[model samples]
Target: MDGGERYQEFDPPKALRPWVRKVWTYACPSPSRTIQRIAPDGCPELILDLGDPYEEADADGVFHLQPPALFAGQMTRPIAIRPVGPVELVALRFHPDGARDWLGRSLRTATDQRLNMTDRLRDLSPPAGDPEAQARQMIDWMAGQRRDDWSIDPLVRTEVEAIHADQPSPPRDASARRALQRRFLDRVGIAPRTLRSVIRFRRVFDHAMAEEAEGWLSAGLDAGYFDQPQLAREFRRFLGCTATEWAREQVELARAIASQSYKPGGPEPG
Candidate 1:
């Protein structure tokens, strides 16, 4: 067996770049039960479990063993993952609008939910082999379905970019905004306002983490929040904890786990 942990990211083939982010893999040997907390990010994910199935704890503390292959929608709250044994995961992260285009289905069906993709994966000819092989097969499947002029709606794409790049302002006109919200829901799975909230919360969290000395107010302002109180409210709403509490816990387990995989000849995680 390979010693220590292994985690790496690979760029998708040029043809798949528009809809897909990078392909990444992470694996670590069996260890005491460990939980990794992932905060909401705007991106959705398609994941294949290459090892033992991991248990997922939702916001309400209910746990379920994840399916072998599943698609995760845009996360709105923190989700905790507890690995049963060894951990091995190969993931294909899609751009906010990318999965909608490739799936050719309303992303709304899977928003904020995890759906089993085992049957969909099994339908492909030449069964998936390993992590890398499965990713390639998935890419090929998407490639086969691509059309000559495949593209996300220009308006949706623009809005998605705007949400991520700067403070997402509500449309000036309420009626027109409602219409766009409906369209965004159809094309993007989640409501545009909700997506904006998730992105804004992520920005604040990341800023606070990166600049601990700047104080939460500064971090909040930098991330477009109105003030420190607003930032704290968002922290509790999305993360189920206050900024100070979460930072004190330093449950940045995902990054720490990934770092373990990067260590050369380092001991396997436990």
Candidate 2:
């Protein structure tokens, strides 16, 4: 990471709030070429690489260069990325149930995959400028892409809200649970239980980063884990590492970016 590196998130415009979570930018005038591990958070992303393209390692540890524009679908595991040069990119993070509308496809088709969107990039090309200006351009393009009849499944939205709020999910019989799972696969790209687990892991990660608790055990407990072993299992499941190991490996830029706070569907700060 360079001293010039920065990561900032901006809220989506009011009309697009239901579909888009946030528009964000990451830039580094001179990157240090460190591999950063990005853990899953249950949201799909549209990433436009405005600067040098990044190298993403596959499951077999083979590094493949990414396209200038791509759609990253719901990831069940962590991915490692290394900057090939100076880095700058604008990203649109869609809510779990929101992407299927903009993408015009089943979310399940894109799960754990980064699909090339270079052809679609022509319409989204940003003029040379600062990241904020580029981000505005991207957001404006997304606004144009919005359809009048676009809408998310009401049941999916309700379940997503429950997960984020850390509230007990509504009681469901086996048949209801199966029905919800089908809807979630089509709209959210993951099972309902998987989403819940990911959100819970996010709380633990945030707590650890904030140092709000004495240790990982306390943080996990605060995040609703039954015991240390359960927390450790989640850590390995989401991050592919223990809690302490993940913290130890976080680069300065990753740490700083992860520490920022924002509530979903809230008003964007000026």
Candidate 3:
């Protein structure tokens, strides 16, 4: 969907453009626990308050934790919630670029280090500058691809198709290819090694409702997992919840939103 009022879901443009942002309704009736989940890109994430009171810092001094060091990419946090109060800010997913060739970098990483988004935006790039223009400049200087800004470019879809095929990388050149790959991964902030895994996991949503209805263990295998244990481990590591738990919460949230989402001749969700 275009950046107008039509946008209702996640969409990111190519490297040379501004990434699309979508925000759904608030999760008012949902639980209040600060559910911490990670995105496929390995970016750090946290569930927003969604109209409820949420504290970033917990009692243990764990300040609303950020993503892992190995992770650095655009982040899509909480799923859209409907049938609740109208939310001021909709959901968000990042099209990260602060890591320089790395898919991302650590917010806590010190300067004299690689590029960081917060630092670049605040310290380096001026606040008055156009963000999209700045992002484009950054990608160009770094010799990276453009953002997949839907209409003009379909790189995101192309990558999605390739990832869905579960294809491995082809043979490399005689040079230090492995080193190059590592360097690229570090620059991208996302190790290429984890791409398929993340893509496959994200694809779970393609049939989440149906498969999860049967059970996550079975769903995981059907979705390419070897066993329930394997799926469980990854789910916990990525989603911060067991398969059963995530499913239950999803079902609840979806159910709560179903009615509003299905009004006859209602606007479609992008």
Q: What TM-score, computed on C-alpha atoms, does each candidate reach?
A: 0.79, 0.91, 0.47
**Highest lDDT, which number?**
2
Model 1 TM-score (2 dp): 0.79
**Residue range 1-270, candidate 3, lDDT tens digits:** 111212123223343223322222223333424342322433321122223223233335454332111122332222222223222222222222223323333323321121223332222231222334333333343333323322211333233234546655556675755664455343333444454566566545333334343554565677688876777677665555655555455533333222222111111222
User: Per-residue alpha-carbon lDDT of model 1 for 141-247, expressed as tens digits?
Assistant: 76787787667676777777777766465455988777777778766788888887777676556544443636766756876788767777888777777765565
lDDT of 1 at 220: 69
Which candidate wins on TM-score? 2
Give the residue spans of candidate 1 off by over 4 A: 1-3, 58-60, 123-138, 145-150, 167-175, 207-217, 244-253, 256-270
The C-alpha stretches of model 3 lying farther than 4 A from their native spots are: 1-7, 10-54, 57-87, 90-161, 173-176, 205-215, 250-270
Query: What would you estimate as the lDDT of candidate 2?
Result: 0.80
What overall lDDT goes with each candidate model? Answer: 0.67, 0.80, 0.36
Candidate 3 accuracy as TM-score: 0.47
Residue 118, model 1, lDDT: 83
